[model samples]
Target: MQETLACFKAYDVRGQVPEQLNEDIVRRIGRAYAEAIRPGNVVVGHDIRLTSESLKQALIDGLREQGVDVTDIGLCGTEEIYFATAHLGVGGGIVVTASHNPKDYNGLKFVREASKPISGDSGLREIQHLAERNVFEATAKRGGYQTADLLGDYVAHLLSYVDITSLKPLRIVCNAGNGGAGRVIDALEPHLPFTFITQNHEADGHFPNGVPNPLLVENRSPTTALLQSSNADFGIAWDGDFDRCFFFDAAGNFIEGYYIVGLLAGAFIEKNGPQRVVHDPRLTWNTIAVVEGAGGEAVQSKTGHAFIKEKMREADAIYGGEMSAHHYFRDFAYCDSGMIPWLLVAELMAQRNQSLAEMIAARAAMFPCSGEINRKVEDPRALMRAVEAYYAQGCTHIAHVDGLSIEFDDWRFNLRSSNTEPVVRLNVETRGDVEKMKQKTEELLRFIDG
Candidate 1:
């Protein structure tokens, strides 16, 4: 009997190193992926994690054994694999990255042709099943492997989204948190007119400071402190793989990702004129208002990269943004990038001659929100149902796109259970009513805990 693999998740592979994810398992994954997807050629890259390189080599060996040509772009962020896959016209792409997970953990993210995500709904389940069975027919031909440096092209593609000449000489703070973003920043520095103050910028798998996760409030201290001390116009922080980026205002205020979503939606509309903007259903008021106000259509999708990307393709949206700081661009193969967002926001600041805080103030005030709060509960589904039963009568609108989202005339909230844990996440917002938003949040928490 074969030992079952536990690293496979709903959308990707993630688990603790050595125990759940070892070289052998990754090698099996490569063979399974090749057999299931049957890609003639694949782009493979790895993050700065200590184990990533070895795991990637094992994966390459398995793929090459199965006659799958490999294009290795070493030591890259997750977005680079997406870019290389679409840019090189490869059959598939895989990036070995855990993206903000603890140092003991690692994972892999995958994309197929055109840089489309490979989630459970797509081919991830099949890949996981095949890997578990650990059976592959021997191939006569061994696939060739080659190394390519596409950094120049990838940087060029990122710069194409903004007007280089229009960027102002603003001072900015960039905190890479010892992740993979610093390399890309170094490459982009020469092309822009901004002065950057970098902290924990080097790629260190040991994570000298901590895991490169900006979502946690505690993890944001370094970036905020640096922004204030340096007197920079704004601050930006990225996750381990740099696929998601969070922002801070000149005042050292961490701006919520929801408002950035609105800002980008409006910017895209102003630039391209009435294009569809896809957004997650978790926080809808601000995004919907901004999109429609700019004469663009706002299409709501279930939260997650796979769903958002699929919705973007279906609507041919110019851009899509999730409150989690994942911004997707149509030009970037409908894939999310941490770099493109700041570049575009910088251009907007330059063009409007306004600070990031000034631009976001009105929208944020108009739609005050309580950022996501997570709670560990015995039955997340039951809690959500009880909350829904209590509020359903008063809510003017209800949606089940990703979870339970109930909307009243002036206030709304979304409650969803985590896919991999026994935790439920809650988000609340009120139209121009901070007190109401706070009150509703407290009420919900009390009820949820009760």
Candidate 2:
């Protein structure tokens, strides 16, 4: 009730555990969410974080107090909660997870009926205001709580993306990063022909091997080392909550999410012809090329799950992808799934008889990129203004759907501030030229630093 908790982020709830997100605070959030969304029943789930169970229980207490039936799916990922909300006929869903945050941190992701995300522009602001007000009306009937296991259904849904029998025996290194993904992997193993070489595979909120963010170059060594030693076909790593996934080729080379977006776009476009594929603005040349080449239309949407999902649904697109490794499927109720992307990638490779690296190499050559670079700056707005002023003279085009996207004759770049942090992110891509991309990336960094 103290001037709105800082944990309420633009997309979801995330903050340091106990310090910023405690049982009492989460309980208030639960009640506020029920009031704002007015769900008859809500599905609740938690990740492997140590504080998750306690926070979930407190949230359930608040929801039940508000006469909202609570369906508890214990120790699950964000996607699992999304699945439960629709599959179990729950009115809404909440997931207690901080994703790639530290062990001392935790958060929550919310969805309305049919797994529609509730973000800042949607209903999160109202929930924040209500939680801060901390006033609630008593209901005539208090709702009861129940537990359900939706793992089998969730796994079955994931397998629906791939032709299981056509998939050849694959040697895969799956690093769950000591999170909830291992449980899903265990559930899926019996139904597949994959030999999983796992590392830090156990669910431990303590994060013994460090947070499982493959985005951080340092956190990638474990999977890289293990994959090389195991001689696996390819390796995959997921964040704490397992909503996003990172890939490493058979040679233990980390593949950037941008190329994966192109690969996945091509796969979807191949099967679902003329289907629209939504993508984020950052590092888009590759994806656009793939989508158009496959006879599908490419639509650009702002980054973030909420924006992409809404745009995908509006376009009735078959698939949407972000350079950050979040892949959304129209079939998966338009929710992003880390599980489905990998399965699709595996199938694409098998059907095409190509290695993961080989599949990416063709696209990489067409649209080489600088990946995404982040830096802390005092005034991101001022920096972007300077960038525009500097490049405006020769720029051929500029788009600001999510941020500043400037295109010239042979190169383009997008510079934007992080939605959740103070850092400014820069992405540079050149048309079929890697050296130009590298040169432009350094040039932009120098200007930003200055």
Candidate maximizing TM-score: 1
lDDT scores of the candidates, listed in order: 0.95, 0.91
In model 1, the worst 10-residue window by lDDT is: 1-10
Which pairs of residues clash in candidate 2, taking residues 3 or more apart in a chain or in different chains? none
Write the residue-wise lDDT of candidate 2 on 12-97 in tens digits: 99999788999999999999998999999999999999999999999999998899999898989999998899888779999999
Model 2, CA-based lDDT = 0.91
Writing each residue's lDDT as its tens digit, candidate 1 over 150-262 gives 99999999999998988889899999999999999999999999998899999999998999999999999988888878889999999999999999999789999999999
Question: Ten residues in a row with the worst lDDT in model 2?
Answer: 1-10
Q: 254 in model 1: Cα distance from truth in Å?
A: 0.3
Error of 1 at 147 (Å): 0.2
Candidate no. 2 TM-score: 0.99
